[model samples]
Target chain A: MQEQWTTTIRPVSGWLNINLAELWRYRDLIALFVRRDFVASYKQTILGPLWFLIQPLFSTVVFTVIFGNIAKIPTDGLPPMLFYMAGIVSWNYFSSCMTNTANTFVANAGIFGKVYFPRLTVPVSVIIINLATFAIQFVLFLCILFYFTLKGAPVHISPWILLTPLLLLQMGILGLGIGIMVSSLTTKYRDLTFLVGFGTQLWMYATPIVYPMSQIPEKWRWLFALNPMAAVVETFRYAFLGVGVISTDVLAFSFGMTLLIFCIGVILFSRTEKTFMDTV
Target chain B: MSDTVIKIENLSKEYRLGTINHGTLYRDLQSWSARIRGKEDPNSKIASAGFKVQIGSFMALDDISFEVKQGDVLGIVGRNGAGKSTLLKIISRVTMPTRGEVKIKGRVASLLEVGTGFHPELTGRENIYLNGAILGMTKKEIGRKFDEIVDFAEIENFIDTPVKRYSSGMYVRLAFAVAANLEPEILIIDEVLAVGDAQFQKKCLGKMEQVSTKQGRTVLFVSHNMAMITSLCTSAVLLDSGKLRVRGNTSDVVLSYYTQYSGSPASFDFRSSNKFIGDDHAMLISGSVVDSEGNVANEFDIRNPVTITMRYRVTRPDHYRFIPNFHFYAPDGTCAFISGPQEVTTESGEFEAVCTIPGNYLNDGTYFVGLALSSMETGVKAHFYEQNALSFNVKDPIDNVPTRNGYAGPIPGMIRPKLDWKIRGVA
Candidate 1:
């Protein structure tokens, strides 16, 4: 367990312990924060949860037109719409998790400042809630691929799809890490809000979202590979579309970065949660 | 039986009043300048020489030591900024101590504020579990006590509604229910009950009593209500300026606190002593309410001037910097009214702050007067008297008459002071 955090006293927050027992006692609260994330955003909206499916569908169409036709980028010989949709489904999950997790401290400071809980439960639940929505969008993407394959489009579903769970974890860990880091900093300097929105878009470009990894320059390929999301999306294309162009080395790099960022993010977040109220 | 379930020994907390952005050019400059001047840096306690008391670092809690026995309700009372909440926050694990240690044998739950850990979009039912889990309750425990919690909160019907749609009462009920259901070994409440209505307050009191006496749980309740502390707490701790005054039997501590209230003559003196004490351009002297015949009046007659007389020191002409101010606080601690000179008390000599209460203005009750004399130009206090604060009670002219608009029933606010009145009409 590596010292198992004998004491977690950050300079900002005093002595905020992981306190698993207290966290276990308040397990119901984790479920509540999850429910809040799931329902609160969609409340009074016209489409409600249906909006989850529409996001990837709309993006898939727009990307198919622009990147497939106008830009004429190779979708690794697969239909550009299906190719981008798969990546979008995965990207949507990470992006939402990142955004929601980043807002954790600012959004829930009222609760956090007044009560004690395993602060980890908040970002953890946010990861879970958005995963559920992303899960729905993923299903829709799969149904589309099935329909396109029936119409005689080249479609390949590999057993690497089984590796989806690991890829998902990699994405969650990375998102959680980055989200927690930004969330902690956002308390002191809220300037991150706009940067995250714009940076996420730029980050997608670096990760080969609308483009394939093969299009990246070989020497600079390592650069994109470092962005964990690029590895997830590349592995995803390899799993469903049989785009085996990705190197195993790139994924190993992604995994290493994921764990590293997640560890650093957790430490920073736990430290920030203690005194965020004083500054926030 | 252990005499103390919680032992807090020599707890000290030091806080830096200024920012510490170290490793910066400005910081190096400041530290270097401090080294040359032999003064401490404004941001840190360290003198350039090292660890000296700087003007910036303040010890919020200095060697605070106390012990709470099982089943004892201890009240920590203090004025604002007196380190009361900070101590409670430290004990509750919501904050940490800078120095010293506290040992607790059992679980501790704190209600420093209400609606904590509540999700606005979540339903009451969902939030109950969510808040319970956040408070360190297991799911099974929350499930088991779910029904009782709903019943206690009296929000069962709206349990499925999002708390955002709830009225404040419903919101507080759900929040308080979750907090109340936390069966920690020790409960810490920090003036949070001020959110509840009188009925809910009584209910919370009953719950706290049950938790302490019936369940043998130790409780530390921080409040300003001497009456509640006197009645509900078994022991009390009085905190003044971040230091302990007395901690012993509740009645004795409360009696000592109330002694500061029994004297009303100071109210008159504070009001009338302005002739010599305040800026002489406007000084108050020998001022007291008097009967029609100019005799010192023990109490105000409804028709009396409530006369306030003052002697002033007129050092020269056109010295209009003197202004008399009177601030009143009701028995319930709500600021009632602040009145002052409508016209300049020029031509210094002595001046007084006085306002005659029109008949029927006040509801019968005890009230306090906080007097201050300030410079009219800068509005800074030339002289303020809080130590000599005065307390007075209005006697019902007709003890049985029992009626005044906006004065009946138990209401909490400023201006509960009573006055004599009559309603007349042409028949």
Candidate 2:
């Protein structure tokens, strides 16, 4: 009699076989991992989750002092604190999600070596945890926005503010995409590990996190738009302070790039998850 | 016939040795460029000067194939580097095999290491949820069994404390408790019971026994403890150096495992060998198993006497008396008995010691002989001790004289000695 099997293990799976149903089955694991990350990071610290707010607040101050006063960089005629806060809040979310997910394979090698679960759950959980942190920082940004609007500091809240969720989703997908891709390579070539931190730092400077896109010449602004993060940061500023440029074509292009990178990342990640234990 | 729950077919796993694929971008680029140029890899050991590199790849599992029926506890026994863990990893989906396939019919929960993904910073209750989720249990499932798990681990008072503060024993107990509560259809355990105390191990064994026998869950176990394998597993497979060596009933496979590692050759000829097993005083010449008729043989009848003969050369003849003894071991590595004569040997150039085991005394199974020589004049000084130097098998025919009495089934014990018995109708 022919027998029916629930699981068949083979050498390699199809390239596009992402196993979405399995990922859905392990959604609880993802939630648990997110909780572990949140609780474990602040176990003995005095500040605990408050650090989420303090980090961006301190960075916004530094940027306001250095770029707003000393260097005299333009923020499209908006308040330096509000402008830097907007950019830092959004940029922090994307960068943290990317770096954390980039270390997924290496950080959890101990657990991964011992058991079997949907490997995608780790990176996905990282995005969720960073999203939680981003939510806290976003509230901080909203309080500063409310104060500036009350003070009548030339702020305009546009209808584009409704696109904030879409913006966060795009950043998450982009971060997960680039993160797992690098993680897959770092398994065999450990040199990529050192590059991730340095590369992300440089990547942040390339985006319009400090200076407004108006500071760049019109000819060179397209080059900045090539960075998917630039559109995210620029669109975020335009939605909140009514400063910086926003174009439907650039937004569409950036979203397309995010999806494309996400597909590639998933492909590389699935391929690496199978036999990475050997090389790792 | 029972349903086949797991079917493994010719699975093999190969791992790259030394540095995997150059380990760095520079070396990897060098190799890649050389490959494109039709030249040997520049980063390869062959291209380097004055360096000897081991083989590029090692096969951890080589063409192993087996099947497990429903509710069958299959024990996998082998020494270290015997492909047992590799096979388990492949089946657990923790690693991919280089070739072949494995089809499993139901949910498999593998305890390759207990408490995997358990964060020390998390409290016991929190870690239970985390570790259970990692082992493929949902949140609601863990919550339903949370009380039972805590009770089984016996850490009711410390359930709220972080596991990092718990003692090692308590930690293992808690970890095992969570795993024991897992209700997967197929359980793959790899030496996880080697931890914990004796009482905990017994509890774990009882739980496993209940899971397989009462609940009808299939189990695949890997362990070095032969006694546990014999008691817990109905059948077993033996692996040696990445190859399947033996597969059969647990008793027979365990016997093969012992004989395989014991290196028993049925006879030893030390006369022509330069590396002698002795000091300057005495050297062993030869040893063999012989039947009652005095002809050299490794098989003996249950009703006939078996003799073990050892020849040795005494270079320094003196008043120091030498004693030669033979230790007979049963199949399970337990010493059945020790036989030696009280007579002393002095002023001897060459000597032969013969110890005869009477008929109908030994059981029908393979037995190993360990030869030794020692002098007791000045002190207990061993001249030579060769463990498992020779082995032989004793056959028990169904029509055996008066011992059987028409019973053909196996009799359980280390020795099956026939004794005189008288029965009368007193009732």
Candidate 3:
């Protein structure tokens, strides 16, 4: 029924031309992994997915107590609770993605060594699952947003809400970029694993999540927004509370930095996927 | 013109053994020294070996090159640490080569180990998609073949159960089904069939045959099982300590492997000091099986029957009830036969325990023999023999068996002793 068939092959010139068809081939796997990440994280847990809401909610209360009252950090004229919630939600999302993907090789070495699949799917699914959790947390922000709106509180859901999707995109890409960069590097240098936890902690302060960009003196304000995550958090507050600083310059610079990091990260990741097993 | 689906020019890999990496604290000092002196750092051995040697660093593979046409199942036979897995990893794109290049066409899938992409907490169905995707199979491809995979794995009910709950057998069955169903343009497997029950292993071989022979997918299989290689692969290559030992017909390459491991009898350094086996009654000080050439030949051919001479020292034969047990194992770790000296004499003595694997009885492959002097009457083993005792290889006498089957890996229920066959009626 079949005649003999054979084909010739050549070394792929370079990895620049990543085949989209191959990725499309694994679309269901991406979806399944995302679903598994989300479902499996809460499986049989007493709190279940409610933990998603609880995280930002609890973090907001803690920040309101420690930073809002204890440290006397200003929330840029908005209610301390809402101001901290926005940052917590977004920050946690990226942190989760980073944490999930950073261990890609160490966690799945057994599988990666055994079978061949586009290695990116594992990290990409982390972004998807964390994004879903962020959406759940976003609903909590809305409940607070509505309460403040009804209380005749001074607030505005700026038309800048249109750009919230951009924030999500930024979070996804930046998380993936940094996560992959660290994962590819950590395959050999495991010191990064220990550093990541504390690093993310210090990184949150650098992002202005508990304080406002305005709290910095005018001369020092430039340094505040230079932190890519700082600009993102500031802009998100500007959109929801209409009270934090927002600038095209800050967003554009952050975007550029994010794009650069992602490019470098993906390049390193692709190169490492070939030989990660040996080192990891 | 396009028959060669795979082509290699020069391939090599090096691994550093006994290497200790310099601590990161010394990084600045090393770099500073290199920059100031315009010379390499003194401790640059490991790093230089990594970048400089490429494949030649320690040379796991030294300039190996070969081609496999579509539908050609290529077997890579090598000893442990011989770089067979490294070659497969590079070709599969799971790992890059230290030197040379591999050009792969078509989608590739690999099964270097069972449950490669499985998440312990994920159910079998979820893992099917995850593992399939990891193997580069599209969702539609996985969906189209989902039922077939489950059916073949015989884990339909368990498909919804978390894979962590699955037994090792179920895990292997499902893993193989997902991998085999990928139907890649190129399938690279590395000793995954070494596990699993006999029936499942047979199914796996049958599936591999169907994938390569029927589906026309090119297969690159790495294994220590020469019987499987000889039977399934159309061509073969042997690697010996990072170099191509032989490359040609499957039969020739397998023979080359066997012959190299089949040590020469002329160089017997008698009193060569074989392993010790004893139970306080009798202890084996030294012994060796000399071939027909009157030299030490631990390994023999399928049709060759030889004598086993042993020298033992008996210490106080009274109340020291023990027997010398000799076991014969097929190459795939299957025991062909075993015999004990006390099967006849319940007495202990400085005796020579000799057992022969009757001629034409064991199907060709490697075999291991172990001598255990144990208290047979008391049923308490005073001493145990392990991975070392006695070992040998049996080569296939190709003249008799024209065609062989690929189902020759770790068969369950030991004693692969070949038995006489007769058909009373054709069912």
Q: Which predicted model would earn the best DockQ?
A: 2
Worst 10 residues of 3 chain A by lDDT: A3-12
Encode model 2's per-residue lDDT on B1-427: one tens digit a residue. 3489999999898987777677898898998899899987867776657555677788898998988898999999998999999998888899998899999988888764755677889999999998888889999999999999999999999999998998887887887777768788889889878888899889988988898999999889999877678778989999988889898988678767776787676677876666588888898889989887788887788888899999898888567788999998875568888888989887768889999998988877778899999888878888899988888877777695456778887676778888887889998
**CA deviation > 4 Å runs, candidate 1:** A1-26, B1-3, B20-55, B112-114, B255-427
Task: Report the C-alpha displacement of residue B2, candidate 2, in angstroms.
Answer: 4.7
- Supply the DockQ value of model 1: 0.18
Candidate 1 vs candidate 3: which has greater lDDT? 3
Best by TM-score, which number?
Answer: 2
Task: Give the alpha carbon lDDT tens digit for every residue of B382-419 in model 3.
Answer: 44443324555556545553223344343333323556
TM-score of chain A of 1: 0.90
* Candidate 1 overall lDDT versus native: 0.71
Contacts from the true interface found in each model, as a fraction, amount to: 0.35, 0.89, 0.46
**What is the lDDT for A19 in model 2?**
88
**Candidate 3 per-residue C-alpha lDDT over A141-227 given as tens digits, one digit per residue, 9 for 90 to 100:** 999988978887679878888899998899789989999888887777677888888999989888878888888878988887667
Residues B1-427 of candidate 1: C-alpha lDDT, one tens digit per residue:
4557777778877777765444344566787798789876565645455655554877777777888888999988766776887788777666667777777767777764656666677788888887777666777888989998999999978989888888887777777777777787888887767776889888988998999999999889988876577557989887666667778987556544543434444224434333345443333443343434555543553322343333334454355466655666654466777677776555544444555655434544444555555565555546434422454444445433334343434443343345456789979
Residue pairs of candidate 2 with colliding backbone atoms: none
lDDT score of residue A117 within candidate 3: 70
TM-score of each: 0.73, 0.90, 0.78
- Top candidate on lDDT is 2
